[model samples]
Target: MDETLREQQLRMTRFIRDPHANLPPPGIEARRLAVYRQLFLGNVQGLLAGSFPVLRATLANDLWQSLVEDFYACHRCRTPLFTEVAGEWVGYLESREDLPGWVAELAHYEWIETVLLLSDSTDPAHEPEGDLFNGVPLLSSLAMPLAYVWPVSQIGPGHVPQKAPGEPTLLLARRGADQKVYFSRLAPLAYALLVSLREQQISGREHLETLAELAGMEWDVLEPQATALLLDLKAQGVVLGTYSG
Candidate 1:
């Protein structure tokens, strides 16, 4: 590329990113550049708005606009696909310190909905059969465990916490057979068990046994409670089926 054209391209991008701060290149009319600026910025803002509607609502207009401008000017998105913009935005929020403490958690809480909605992956090998206790419990492919300190699942227009709790809020978001995504609040132990089931790929009984040992409880006492929890999870479709492996 020619030196002048390269400089023009850089300047054009800079202007588009922060039109309020940077003037358009010398030859280009300010009016035409303003149009381009709006078109570019508006599209990004609209996409992010759709992705994180609650976060946008929680912040005042000026704060939201400044946040979006900062994102546009500073963040270099990893993916080229437009649909992946939300993921990129979440990544950007992970590194920022100026925004509210809940911003990153809330952003990820919102982004997971989009991810589960768009997922096409399936667990066709597992037949929805066998006893959950003896057979290996297969976690729902669509199930995602999120541990956040700010109680992000509870945050919205009505409620926004100023500080994170001492203990993390564990949530499980799962897509059911009906294709609706549901959010379930998990007790710390339940959350750990589900994570262990997924990570260890073991039998439900074994998972619960380990949990019981870790908690210094007798297996007989924990067994009944563990069985009840498993049954509830199965009913909710968060536990898809049992795998014998």
Candidate 2:
């Protein structure tokens, strides 16, 4: 006999799920129900396709359109503010254990540029005080250190052809002194160090030691590569500040 709140909520959710579903909930106008549906779907599609331009070009439009719809319908975004929908898209792939291995990796690669551009940091992340070779600081915000199980950025025009690359590519994306964006491929060890430092919450210098320890690599070999990685991270504006005492 009672109109349950749970039932009402589900009814409202259906309106969002099916754009054309006609429901006259007070704030929403019945006559223009389809407009809101189309508008919401359109904006999301643009961002998704824009981030994965190469992938969008590769897939049939219908398939691509369906992908965006699935993401919209299922994803409960962490950030409601949405300046970084692209980052959340990357997060979606990074967290999904069930995704096809190649598909998840490619999504991460395709979404990288969007993540960098929409990163709202006016200043770089904290950099630590240390010497290169003696020990080096690793990268953080203001710079985006990226790793993919596949080489997404390198597959431009025809380099990797239609399928995934045999090897992974390490990418460093950062804003320069002049505020221009740059991306460079990194060596596996350097990428491992940067990724460990950023995503794993390991400190820069310690992360290098981590790689060396894990691989039984001589710290001597890690020293120069880690040093180079830090310098490049700083020059690219990755270091926001020196880690303080």
How many clashes in each structure?
Answer: 0, 5
Q: Which candidate wins on TM-score?
A: 1
Candidate 1, residue 192: Cα displacement in angstroms equals: 1.4
In angstroms, how far off is 233's CA in candidate 1?
1.8
Q: Where does model 1 exceed 4 Å of error?
A: 1-7, 19-23
lDDT of 1 by residue, 107-130 (tens): 999999999988998774664766
Worst 10 residues of 1 by lDDT: 122-131
Identify the leading candidate in terms of lDDT: 1
**What would the per-residue lDDT of candidate 2 be over residues 132-196, giving only the tens digit for each residue?**
33333445565666767666665543444455567766787876556566888777776676667
**Looking at candidate 1, what is the lDDT of residue 192?**
80
